[model samples]
Target: MAKVSISLDAELVVEVMVLAGVGSPQDAIEAVVRDYIARGHRTEARTELKDEALRELDAKPQEPQG
Candidate 1:
């Protein structure tokens, strides 16, 4: 993978490091990013399941009216 250089606020980096419990700023940021991506994937999967269930309900035959 290619590496890129960027500047970030020192305070923000320290906060992230503390929250992530990682000694290195790079590892802290990376951990947060990976967690965010995983959360997004889980949310998307749940949405897909809900959509599929709705479609199935729509496709089911209804009882005739009295």
Candidate 2:
């Protein structure tokens, strides 16, 4: 674990700690960061899949039926 110090909003940190139900500021911050990363991954995957689907739709030839 790396020890570094940065300033944050005191009120926000307190709110996060209360919401996360964690006693320490470090734990609350870690949880928030982890959630943010996971959400980004999910969003990226969703966008990739959507792009692939659009490309596939454009590539497929439409059949004409009488």
Index of the highest-lDDT prediction: 2
How would you encode candidate 2's per-residue C-alpha lDDT over 24-60 as one tens digit per residue?
9989998998999999999999999999999999999
> Compared with the true structure, what per-residue lDDT tens digits does model 1 show for residues 7-65?
89999999999999999999998899899999999999999999999999999999999
The worst-scoring run of ten residues by lDDT in candidate 1 lies at: 1-10
- Deviation in Å, model 1, residue 65 alpha carbon: 3.4
Candidate 2 CA-lDDT value: 0.95
**TM per prediction:** 0.87, 0.81
Off by over 4 Å in 2: 1-4, 62-66
